[model samples]
Target: MMLLDLFAVIAAAVLSVRGAPALTQDPQAAERPTAGVFVATDLNWGGDTLWIPDASNGSCIVLPAPFYQGTSSFGPDKGIACSLWYHDDCDSRNPSFGPLRTPGVSTQADWSNATYNPNSIDNNGIAPNSWDKQVTAFNCWNVGEDGLHID
Candidate 1:
């Protein structure tokens, strides 16, 4: 996102949190921000990076570009930080429900040429292994990627 756009988002978020009359309608209907996909060049959510914004709740997003070989995060939007996993196939076993997090070792020349199937993910920042690079599918929110709730 652009700097101004990001700033606007932050400002709006602050306003919403602080109860801006126009922005605040039903207090009980408030929502939390969603942290989308974050990629790092190194392991353990470290190194140079790139990030994709959160997809809408219950929506599936297939990356059309290349972003292979790196660590990942669920972002800090939710109340509690949690561990998450990713899958390679978009089948019954690898249903598209829940966010993705992973770090992997890839030998591909670039993001496009690289295969991204991160076998495992560790959001607790304590997994012994890195993310797998052979990935095609991932986990995301069961409801939507817009709220703070985890399922």
Candidate 2:
């Protein structure tokens, strides 16, 4: 029927328009950027986004603002660099969900001053180190006001 054909055409057009970057699956993909922790900066994920938690930890990236401008500039003075870690919300190791493997940081004060590095290659949940792939459906976390940020 004409209606069926029209429906197919419409569906095809919709799919075409909805096309976005395909996330990778291999965590060690060379195209992926190295993970790093940024401090004292509000993240701009290009557009509004949410963090999907995984069984081991939550992984997400905050694309710098002026997204289309192809610039790496962030924060007033730029962000501070730090290490990375993975921890679940319910993780007994670090219940607050922060960097788990910080160098030279062993106490609360150290943690406060430590940097958190997220897996950049895992942003799309492709790489072996993907963080958000295991998130429960409809469950997500938002960035904080004054805490560590990752990309």
Candidate 3:
């Protein structure tokens, strides 16, 4: 009986020590950031978007072209403002993922440049908008399980 008890204790200790790293390691760890492409269309603007980590670069997150529209900002008059949103760890490297014209505007005419607006909004700024015509865009990526939901 004494030998059996000692063996069980030793086994438990060894298992615990061996399993510590696996248990502590983040299961949802984001892969190294890299350059990737995503597209947002008129149909799914209100739905959620996913941000998969890039395997190439360790600190960059690629955004889709239509990720931000000027009109989606303060009001309809502003149009779609070119913007990017990601975790603070993301570094913007690709310009193509930045911004471009909306298609109808002449290529010759210089318009407003798409801004690098980070989607890292604080909890206090998430109040619901009262405007009827406003088209609000959200950053569904990188949000943990406790994030707020858009109705």
If scored against the real structure, what TM-score would every candidate get? 0.35, 0.20, 0.17
lDDT per residue for candidate 1 within 1-151, as digits (tens), equals: 6999999998889656533223111211335355444443333443344444464343434433243323332232333222223333334333122232222222222223333323434322322243333333343543334535565
| Candidates in descending TM-score order | 1, 2, 3
lDDT tens per residue, model 3, 8-35: 8988896565432121112123232342
| CA shift of 88, model 2, Å | 27
Q: In model 3, which regions exceed 4 Å deviation? A: 19-89, 92-151
Lowest lDDT sum, 10 consecutive residues, model 1, at 20-29
Off by over 4 Å in 2: 20-115, 118-151
Alpha-carbon error at 13 in model 1, in Å? 28
User: Could you tell which candidate, 1 or 2, scores higher by TM-score?
Assistant: 1
Q: Residue 58 deviation, candidate 3, in Å?
A: 16
All candidates' lDDT scores?
0.36, 0.27, 0.27
